[model samples]
Target: MTQIAEAVIDENGQIPLMEPLHVIGPHRALVTVLDEPPAGWDETLMAAEKALADDWLRPEEDEAWAHLQ
Candidate 1:
């Protein structure tokens, strides 16, 4: 199955929606849509690098991140 991320709103709060993927054949797969257009390649890469540098690397945070992975 293919997973698509989306934003959804309800009583509790906004939630992310995922679109299901269909398998057409043994070696083929298809997804209907994208949430948004892709961001600038260079800008996106720079932003990611900046974010990584800004966030302090602590032991507890590292452990939590590992759990997510």
Candidate 2:
């Protein structure tokens, strides 16, 4: 049986499982660390901020799209 759980490691290099194992006495497990955010996070935010900074609703732009409004 395979089980997956998320845990944080303490300063003493120990991670406490949130739940008990169903299988009996001794078992082997694998631990992986996910310490970084997803890729392109900063770039996505910067692009969004740049888009908001543009004058998309200016008088000229508004008139151009007045039919839609």
Which structure among the candidates has the greatest lDDT?
2
Q: List the residue pairs that clash in candidate 1.
A: none
- lDDT (0 to 1) per candidate: 0.57, 0.76
Error of 2 at 10 (Å): 0.7
In terms of lDDT, model 1 sits at 0.57
TM-scores, all models, native as reference: 0.26, 0.43
Residues 1-69 of candidate 2: C-alpha lDDT, one tens digit per residue: 898976666679888876766777788999988876436667888988867667674688889998997
Which runs of model 2 end up more than 4 angstroms from their true locations? Answer: 37-69
What lDDT tens digits, residue by residue, belong to model 1 across residues 1-69? 554444434358544344644557665433344455444646878879867866747676788789678
- Candidate 1 matches the true fold with a TM-score of 0.26
Report how far residue 35 has shifted in candidate 1, in Å: 20
**In each prediction, how many residue pairs overlap at the backbone (N, C-alpha, C within less than 3 A)?**
0, 0
* C-alpha lDDT (0 to 100) for residue 59 of candidate 1: 75
